[model samples]
Target: MNVSNATIEDVLNRLTNQTKLYFQRDNNTISVTATSPSTAQASPGQNKTVSGLITDATGEPIIGANIVEKGTTNGTVTDVDGNFTLQVSGNAVLQVSYIGYLAQEINTTDRTTIDITLAEDTQALDEVIVVGYGTARRSDLTGSISSVQGADLTSRSTQMLSTALQGQVAGVQVTRNSGGPGAQGTIRIRGVTTLSNNDPLVIVDGVPSSLNDVIAADVETMTVLKDAASAAIYGSRAAAGVILITTKRAKDRQFSFDYNYEYGIDRPTTRPTNGDVIDWMNVQNEVKWNDGASDPYSQYSQETIGSWLTNHAVDPYHYPNTDWMNLLLKKSTSHEQHMLSVTGGTEKLRTKSTFNYQKGDGYYESKSYERIAGRVNNDYLVNDWLRTNIDLDFSKSNAISPSQINPISHAYLASPYYPVQWEDGRYADTKDGENPLAALRLGGTNRQNYYKFGGKAQIDLTPLEGLTLTAIYAPRFAFTKGKKFTRAVPLYYENGSMTYMAAHRTTNLEETRND
Candidate 1:
């Protein structure tokens, strides 16, 4: 059209398809434009190629942005340049998305190219959190409540349920009575609230139970209701706070099994060392002289004292100055725990069962604990309007220790000059000496066995929308049997001979309790 020999009027006259082209004249040049291609007029049944670029607010390309046709899986991912091409219906709507960004939809009504920008999502502030007997959004909670997940319990080597929370939560104090095997600590939230009893209310799977019977392996979540407003639902029983425990439930799956085991050694943190025979005699002499009396130890000549000091180590049975602390206590004790669980579910029913066994030896001989526990939880959707749940748990524990006085206290109080055994293999019991090792080996014995069982059955009927009629019945039973046997022997003098007019007595006690 710009030929030097052809005039502008002549070129316009020779154009046969003027309606399909448009011309515009500028100060220095002429421009021509043609109609769009046939792909722009494609129908729903026809497929067309669409391409686009995606970016964030900072104008930087977003890698791996998903470009998909609405309601379908036909999609493509963006390249390093934030460009993507996909084959889709001409009238299709695209769903563009990326992680941590809000998704968007765009319509491709007569276009072949699209450009999208996504904004970051900020919906985590409204996340739902678990509360007492229900769940609420974080924004709706006004009282104090602390929650601990199952993962936190799995990493610790705690055998008792209450020991797992030691030092893990604020405002919660856990104190163990002693370093004895299977010792359970006391958990007090926000300090003591009552003068008589400061123990918090422990609820396991909606059933009131002792914390010792609840195995740590079966717990799914532990929530503490700390404030009065949050614990008001429990009434006067929750004056010291409330501990809600929820056990693991069966998931939607076929059959699954899990096993866990732990084994470790236990030892006392400190051992007391007392003075030997020579030191004991010298102290006894000093005490007598200080009391305005002559030395009572003068009855034993200098030669006897020198012999005791020389032969105490070589002939421990004859002239023994034994270290009762080390002789009566072991270097270290051992403990073992095992847990097994099975879970299964179907379209209308789900069930879970677990079994746990634990055994621990105390630092002293003849002191130990053994326990076995099992639990079963099941739920069934009988029909569209009827549902039911069943839960059953049983535990049996046996604890054995000295009935009268603990061995550690006896060892510290007993005189060090007393030998553990005489030369004739008889327990030594002099006029002024009490062999603590004899009390631990042939003294009083106490054994206690406790059995607990709890069962719950619940029925729920949904008669209308947002309304449910429920009924629950839970029964708990416990039996404790304790046996005590004390051996009373005649008092002996310097030799292994009973005193004149002395008699031996034996007593046996059996106790049974039910609740």
Candidate 2:
């Protein structure tokens, strides 16, 4: 056991000689194999040198094909001529593998020369990816682009298409700007490229649009152009990056209808912790004493603090350790989404329609978001050389929240000693005029409403064998309306005394814009 000065080989020899074990050394490590009296004298299997030519199903040579011995680390790759020579034990299985091809296992039991033919993996290589202005097979594209299928986007419960795009691609960063309901994340491709706006140009079905305007369920494919060369078609608008989105269209002679519903809960994972009344008063007194002050910094005296600690359990309404976070926020907010899609068409005429509705509540009370969107796409084959397509999309959304004060920030600043409400159902006064609960319940309302309508028509004419002429017309209209109403709130002390009015005035403001 104490072989500090012994070499590895010497230790291994000692271990092998003392027990019925055999050691095999490989790359600075020794592996032990047990040996018994019945098979201890058996001879090792003989290794045979096998040479083979690997080819695809088309009878073409496939260079760099991997030839690995089954259940072992012995492997070799084919040379330029698709010829590989590997030494393997008798009765060994030769596993042949290549990219974009199905692997095959050949049993080289009694043969010295073997030939393998690997079939093309059509499912892996035949995926059609949408690129700029057109589509290409996955194996044919050589650009800096990443594709996400619609099935993958709708696999999870997400309110925004941008939210579902997070972690779906490489070199892309999706950061959320806020934690409010139905919030969309800001995406940055290959890091920040400009100071003003780094948002990628979003193109939906050949028309410039917003990511939030497209429903996740309606997406057929989402492709991101990471490099400048791949996004060169958009000119300066694609200086940051580009995101091409293609919505689903009608299939040939197929009629299908689908309805999907999702429900999710949102809760804050972390919250700021503030000291209780006793701890606050103690810290205040300590700060004043350290500052060489004659009296405590806080208005409450030591006797009052002691009385609060003693009677807070029985009389919580008067001397309470109020948790502003819990008072301002609910335990958990919920969101729900519903989608309905109808697709029916023939070989000449095709049509697809989708409708989506979503409602979500923010972590804070009295904060909510709602949206409804619909899309319709139609394709017409007028003749052998003429084809027409039409697309229409519309959406409306409303976001409501408190306008007077930020409830979250105010919650962190509000003192814990103050009670949310007095025993007589009156709002309690805080050192600061802002009470998060009061601001949420009685403060002004900030409502933002947005409406969007987009229409596109395209005609394709083929006059020659390989010549085609195309014309497209797209028009988009958007309307935004904002309304805010501020109301005054009065606070009362425990003894029914009046404090300063919180807002002190009433104001109504409305704004509308068309684009």
Candidate 3:
């Protein structure tokens, strides 16, 4: 109380006991300001060292748990003993996370030591799964069933829905029927059951369907019933297995618009390796000599072989050492997908709609696939006792491939000495009359077009508690059109003259199916 004889420092210290204040002296001019409790406890820009131990809910030390300062990249991981020390700024927050465990955040204000216990993430086990004719929680199901989310399927960037299921579900083996664009894979659930068809029966939105008729982006969840007990509802039809596909639907009283686009490049994992023309000529001569020929270079003279080796580099077009695989197949093919979704409605009526377009190029020329698909789902609640639902989906796809022969096989067998094209841009002849480049570029196309339209409608009436009557009507229509055309490809000499017709043949076929 008697500050007249005390210095400024002593006076301030005595006054701080009764009321917290901040004082600043500028060359003997003293200024004081009132301060809050929090400001008096910690100063700005001050840092302190904090240490913590992380453990699981059962009090077991959790090794390798990550601890990070909130809003900063400064972070550290727990040691083998589950202990971590970190330097953090005043009033800093620490975020602790680990796999299969819930994350925790702790404030380090007025504290030097902290301990955390993480809880197990039971979200996956508590998820609701669609089974046979109804839905049940995963923990409640005893049968062998696996579920894959729609997001997981789309992340793989596969064109066919069957291809997206590869390696995602346990005990489910998916093998591609072909490498061409828009090709579907064979899905064998629990291995082969019969000698005939091993294809699993696919059900989309409670209706029998094909995987090709569904789009990955439009799926909500995929459930596979592996054992007979889980798929007994379908009887003998589920002999192989049963796959249930649920499409996305609108939520009540929510409005959202989403657009997604993906672009990717597909490259062959391996390519055929061929030697240069000189090596090929030497091998040919050796083969003839081994076959008891008097002159090894009878067909390919030594002088001609030497001329090719000398001029091949200078005049590659005429005396070319062609790599037929590289010439026929592109380095990389491109594929893209576009999706637009709209979801909006009131409490009484909800609706969801999606439109998708996908285009992909094959590794070989004259090979590609394109598809356009659209879906609409609507739910209406007439009253608490009555409800109605409707779903509509349509897709059109076109696949173009080389007709008649397999160009990839031909490329492996074709000679490396022949030029892909002569100086005059005419196809050159091969030893086997199978010029892969000519077949890829000049060959006719085999085109297949598929169109599908499907609709599902349902009505429900509830007359009493826990008692409801339901009726459903589902109809699907599919049409497929295929056309194959093959024509002759002429082989020309180096001087731009037609040497001979390279096994040319004319064939035309067209087929159409509706179901």
Candidate 4:
């Protein structure tokens, strides 16, 4: 067993002379078979199974390694213990591959059991990464840059690209300014640089565009330009930083279709839940007494205080203690999104088309946002000398909000002792008090619609090898329309009936902006 100087011939001769065994040469190894004085085996079309363990050079199990027959789709991946079971025809060759490892092809002739060790592919370590104007190998980069793939973006439950970017990159700060649905998050690269708008310049497919216009599912990659050296090409607008977003495109001469739907709910982390009616009355009385007010019960009688504590809906609307926050704000708001895309190509032409729709409700009633967007991109090669590209995108968005006051702020500040409405179904009002519930009921709506459209065309003429002519033209248009209407609301009440004595006022406004 310890014969170190023995040759292959000696070993084979000893094995043949000692036992009824025969050896044959595999690619780089030895295969052993028993010598039987009987009939030969059957044909190669019969079904058989091949099982083994795949590992690395260090003999550690390589989970999820792909094992398949040579020229077909029959394949299986390794299990947790690097064990694989593959069913194939007799004497089939097995091809194995894993990420970051070199692939191997093993011959399965007259052998059903074997182990494989794949060497690490060192060349992949210097893989090329996309940059601002082009690409560079990771080892050849001198500036700071971060890249994220589209698959990572689509996995998040977000309506806009900005919100999905949170925590996805280093040296980037992303924050949601408010808890309003469909609100875009604020992003600062390498911190703020100025007192004015410190937003980074966003470049979509080589044109300046807003993140709201680009759907998360339509993005192919996002690259952040962090340092001055990496952003200098963009001038003043790039003082903070720059973001380059590339949309998806057809990669080969095959057709593909994708559909994705996401539905979720958003709720406020904390709501303004002050004390109940009885607790509120008691605390107000204590405050009045502490401030040297003589008559603590001057505002209401003991009977009224007991009625408030009992919460008897006797008159239904006359004497009520309304939980304004609960009445005005919903516990959770619904959100939904849908996206569809088609991609196909030939060697001469390639096309990708996408459509996306989104709708979400705000925390407050009657507050919501809706949007629909579509994009189409095409590229054509008119022989090897000339090529052309076309990209078109359009989006329409509508938002609705309360005209007068934000419901959340009113819910926290207004008193909750008064009823939202009177017995005759009239809006409740007080002379000196502002009813949050009344404000919600009487306030009008402000609506705004945004229309964005952009298109670009480029042609390349490769007349010579190192010198070529290029022509490009891009046009963008945006229009916004807003409408607001307000009506005079009773300010306050006297006695049991409403009694605010003010002149009725009405106003109508319409605004339009274009760029």
**Highest lDDT scorer:** 3
Among the numbered candidates, top TM-score falls to: 2
Off by over 4 Å in 2: 1-99, 103-123, 270-274, 289-307, 500-504, 507-515
lDDT of 1: 0.78
Model 3 C-alpha lDDT per residue in residues 1-515, reported as the tens digit of each score: 76687787788777777676766555879767686445655543888788989999889999999999999999999999899999888789999999888888998887778999999888966899999877999879899999999999988888999999999999999998588789889989989997878898899988899987899988999999999884459988888999999999898888999999999989889875767778888888899889998998866898988899578879987687887777777889999999999999899999999999999998888889999999999999999999999999999999999876577776677778777777767778765465767766666788898989999999989999988898989998888888877777877766665644354544446565654
Candidate 2 residue-wise lDDT, 337-408, digit = tens:
999999999989999999999999887876899999999999999998999999999999999988777777
Which residue pairs collide, candidate 3?
A: none
Task: Report backbone clashes per prediction.
Answer: 0, 0, 0, 4
The C-alpha lDDT values of all candidates are 0.78, 0.84, 0.85, 0.80
Error of 3 at 475 (Å): 1.0
The worst-scoring run of ten residues by lDDT in candidate 4 lies at: 499-508
Arrange candidates by lDDT, highest first: which order? 3, 2, 4, 1
Candidate 4: the clashing residue pairs are 430-492, 430-493, 431-492, 431-493
User: Model 3: number of clashes?
Assistant: 0
* Model 1 spans > 4 angstroms off: 1-129, 285-308, 313-318, 383-385, 430-433, 463-466, 499-505
C-alpha positional error of residue 142 in candidate 2 after TM-score superposition, expressed in Å: 3.3
Worst 10 residues of 1 by lDDT: 499-508
What is candidate 1's CA lDDT for residue 261?
85
